[model samples]
Target: MAKAGNGNWFARHKVITAVAATVLFFGVIGAVSDGEPDTGDEAASADQDWQPDAENDDQSDEAEPAVAEEPTPEETEEPSDRDKTPKSPEPDVEREYLVVHIVDGDTLELGNGETVRLVGIDTPEVGECGFEESASRLRELVGGQAVTLGESDEDRDQYDRLLRYVDIGAMDAGYRLIRDGLATARYDSRDGYGRHPREDAYIAADRRSADITCAPPPEPKNFADTGGGGNCDPSYSPCVPLYPPDLDCADTGPVTVHGSDPHGLDADGDGQACGGD
Candidate 1:
C-alpha cells in the first residue's frame, strides 16, 4: 500500500511541472512576437486605447489643403503707375453724345461726326515732349464717359481745334486734370461758348503753376524803370496787370477770362466778357 501511494505522488508532481512550463512559454511568446518592451497587460491596454486617435491623425493628414484668403481692396496693389490716377470723371452728363474717336490731346471726334476741341486747356501734342503720357491721360479722362459739346464764339480755330466747354457734371474732369498737373488751362473768347462754372476753379489751379519750382521762370521784362514804354499791345502784354504768369504779349491770343465780375482787357472785337487778350 505504501509503494502505491509513492507512485501516485510522483505522477501528480510531473503533471504540476508540465502546467507551469506551458504558462511560461505562452507569456514569453507574447512579449517577444512584437519586439516591444513589455509592461504587462496594463501597458498593452493603454496602447489599444490610443489606436483610434492614431487612425484619426492619419485621416486628417490625407485631407485637402485649406484655401488661401483673398486680399482686401485697399490691400490690392495697382498694376501700374497709370492706375494711380483716374483718367476720367464718373459719367454723369445731362446730355448724351458718343465719342467717335480721339484726335489728340484736348480734341475728340463726336458721334455726330463733329470734331470737338476742348476749350480752356492745352495738352501736349503728338511727337511733343510727354505727348504720349498726355494722350494716355486724356484717354483715361474721356474714354468711357458721356460727353456734351458746349459751343463757343470761335467754333473752329486755325488749328481746327473745336473750342467747347466740357462737363461731366460737378466733377469737372478738365479742371481736375489740370490741377493734377496733367494739362494746361488755356483760355478762349466767351462770345461763342461762354464760361464754365468750374472755369475759375481751373484758373486758380493754373495760377499755382507759377509756384511750381521745377520749371524755369519767364525771361525778365524788357520794360525800362519807367515801366510803360513797350510798343506791345497792353491787352496781351504781361507788363500790364492781369496777364497770366509766364505768358508774354505774343502768347496772348483770343482767350476770355471767366468768373471775374469786373471787366478786363478785350482780346477779341466782341464786347462780351473775356472776349479778347
Candidate 2:
C-alpha cells in the first residue's frame, strides 16, 4: 500500500473516475443499439402506443355473420303416395248421364238421346214372366234421375247400346236386379263374353237371387167331374184347369176338341191338344 502520488489521477480520484466510467458505458451501449436492429422486447415497448385502423385485435377476434344452410332435396320434396293403401270404390263409377226413359230392366235411354244397356244382367222379354216387375222396378230406381256409369271390358253391344255398369246414389242397378231375382247375370265371361270388373260380384249376387217360379193354374173341377164345384177351362170339351195361370197340352193331357181352343192346346191348329203325343 504505497502512499497516493498527486501525478496519478486515477489512483488519487477513484470516486470521480468510477462515475465517469459508468456514464461512458451507457453512452457506448446507446451508440451500439442505434447502429443494429431493435430487439423484440424493445420494439414491443415502442409499439405500446400504436393503434390498428380496424377494431380487430387478432385474426381470430373477428366474428363472421351467421348463415343458414339450405334444405336438401329429400327434405324439401313432397310426399308420394307409394306407401298409401289403395281403395276400391263399390263400382268405381265415373261417367254420369241423366235417365230420360227406362226402356226395360236392363236397358236405358239417356237425356242426350243415347241408349245404354246395363252390363252383366238380362231381364225377361216384354211378354215373358216377371217382365213387368223388372221394368217397373227400373223406373222406380232411375227414372228421370242422373246415374253414374262405369265402363266394363265391353263397350257397345250388338244392339248399338253402350254397355256399362250403372249406379244411382250408391245403389248398383245390375247387382240389385240379380239379387232380387228380377234379372240373371249374363253376357259376361260365364257366357263366353268379355270379363267385367264386377263379374265376380254379379255372380255372387246371382247365387243369392230368389228363385222365381210362375205359379201354375189350379186344376179345374167341372160339376160334371163329380168331385167339386165349377172352375174349368171352357175352351175344352171336358173342361180342364182354371185360368189364373195359363197351361199347354202337357198340363191337361189330350184335351178334347172345342171352339176357340183357348190355351192354343191345338199346336197344329187341328183343334186337338196333347193328342199328338
Candidate 3:
C-alpha cells in the first residue's frame, strides 16, 4: 500500500517483469524440443505439373513406317512374237513368180524364165520310168505354189542353171522325192534332210524297177554299120557303108544317139558304131 502511493516507487518493479519473460522462453523451448527441418514450402512447389519437349514428340511420330507405292503396267512389259521367232540364215528367194515350166527330170523354169536345178537330188532321164513321175510330182508340189529356196555351194552350174533346194512348209521336196522312190539322194555340197534317211529303200526300188523303168541300151540301127548282127533283121538290108553314115536313127533306139567324140560314134573301141557291142 505504501509503494503504490507514488509513481516513482514503480521504477523499482523491473525484477518482477524479468521473472515473467524467463518463464515464457522456457515454455517455448519445451514446445520445440522434437528435431525437425522446415520443408512445407518446397513440398507445395514440387506438386506442380511437368511438361516434355516438343522436339521429342516430333521424333516419336517420325519413327512410324511410310506408305508404299505400286508399279504400273509399263514397268512390267514382256517380249513380242518377233523376239521369239528365229531369224533365217539363208539368202532370200526372189519373189514375183507363178508357173514353173518343166525343164527335165530335176530342173524347172520359173514364170520369169529363171531356171532352178533341184539341190541334193538326182532323177533319171526323160526316158526313165520314174522320170516323168518325178517331174509330175514336183509340178504338183511347186508348179504354181510359192516356196522357200536354199542354194548350194555353187551359185550356177556349168549348164548356167541355178542350183537350189525347195521347201514347202516343213517338208523338203528333195527328201520327199527320195522317199517316194522317184529320185536318188545326192549329197553334193549342201545337206538337205540330212544324209539320205531312206537310202536303202530308194536303192532297192531303183534296182527292182531297173529292167522295166530304165532306158534300154541303143540298138544297132544298121548292124552292118556297127559290125553287129544285121542278118537277124532281114527286112533291113545289111549295107557295108562306112560308120557314122551321117544318118540319124533316133527312132531305132529308146535313147538319143549323138557322136560325142571323134571316133565314128564307137566309144568303147569295139569296132562298132553306136550300139554294136
Candidate 4:
C-alpha cells in the first residue's frame, strides 16, 4: 500500500508538469503573434509619413512646370502693337503717272496731256529773276520720271490746270524746290484754294531759302538816252523804265509796244507785253 501511494503521487506530478508546458507553449505563440502585429503597425506608420514627402516632391516638380509656362501669354502679346505701326502709311496703294513735260518750276504736263500745277508753291516766271534756275532744277528732278499726285481741296484752278502735289520717286517735288531756294510758298485766297497738306514744311523751307540775297535791279535808261525817238510812257507802254524797275513777266501787265523793246522784256514775241504764260 505504501508503494502504490508513492506511484500515484509521482504520476500526478508528471501530469501537472505536462499541462504547464502546453500552457507555456500556447502563451509564447500568442505573444509572438501580437509582437509581429505591433511591428507591422510601426512599419505602416513610417511608410505613411514617408509617402507625404514623396507627394510633396512631386508637387514641387509640378509647381516648377507651372512656373515655366507662365510667360507664354506675355510673350504672345508683345508683338501686337509693333506689327501694326509699320502698316499705317500704305505707300503701295498710291496712284502713279508719268511726267511728260515740265511746264515750269511749279507746273508739269502729264503723259495724258493734262496740265498739273504744283500745290503750295510758286516759282519765278520765264522772265523773272530766278526763272531759268528754277525751271532747270525742276527738269532735273522729274523730267521723264514716273510721279505720284496727291489731291487737295481744289481739283482745278481758274486757269483749268489740275492742282496737285507732285511726288517724284520718294521726293516731294514742291518741297524740294522750296528747299533749294527755287520757289516760294503761296496760296490763292480768292479762289477758295486751301492751304496745302505740307504747307508748314514748305513755309519752313521758304524761310530757309530767303537768306540768299538777290542783286538789285539796274537803274532804268531812258529811250532817248538809248538813241530811240519813240514817244512812250512807262506807265502806259512797254518802255525802258518798267513800273517796277525789276518787272518780272508776271508783274508786267498788258502794254502797247510802239516801235522797239527798250527793256527786252518780251521773251516770246507774241505781240503781248510780257509773254510768260
Winning model by lDDT: 2
Query: Can you write out model 3's per-residue Cα lDDT over 144-204, one digit (the tens) per residue?
Result: 7777766555577778887777667677676667666777756542344443344454455
| Candidate lDDT (C-alpha), each | 0.61, 0.79, 0.59, 0.74
**Positional deviation of residue 22's Cα in model 3 after best superposition, in angstroms:** 34
Candidate 1, position 43, lDDT: 82
> What's the CA RMSD of model 2 in angstroms?
12.6
lDDT string for model 4 (1-277, tens) is: 9999999999999999999999999999999887765777798888876757778899888877554455666566656676768655555887788888888889989998889999988999886788878888989998898889988778998999999999967799999988888888888443456766687787888888763246777654334234223444443353444333555444444454554555556656654565323
After superposing candidate 2 on the true structure, give the runs of residues whose Cα lies further than 4 Å from its correct spot: 1-95, 218-277
User: Which pairs clash in model 4?
Assistant: none
**Candidate 2, 18-120: lDDT as tens digits:** 8899999999999998999758878898778676646454533556655789998877867579747576668843667899998889998998888999999
**Superposition error at 103 for model 4 (Å):** 3.3
CA-only RMSD, every prediction: 20.3, 12.6, 13.5, 11.4
Sort the predicted structures by lDDT, highest score first: 2, 4, 1, 3
Comparing 2 and 4 by lDDT, which wins? Answer: 2
- Backbone collisions counted per model: 14, 0, 0, 0
- Local error of candidate 4 at 41, Å? 4.4
- How many clashing pairs does model 1 include? 14
TM-scores, one per candidate: 0.37, 0.49, 0.41, 0.53
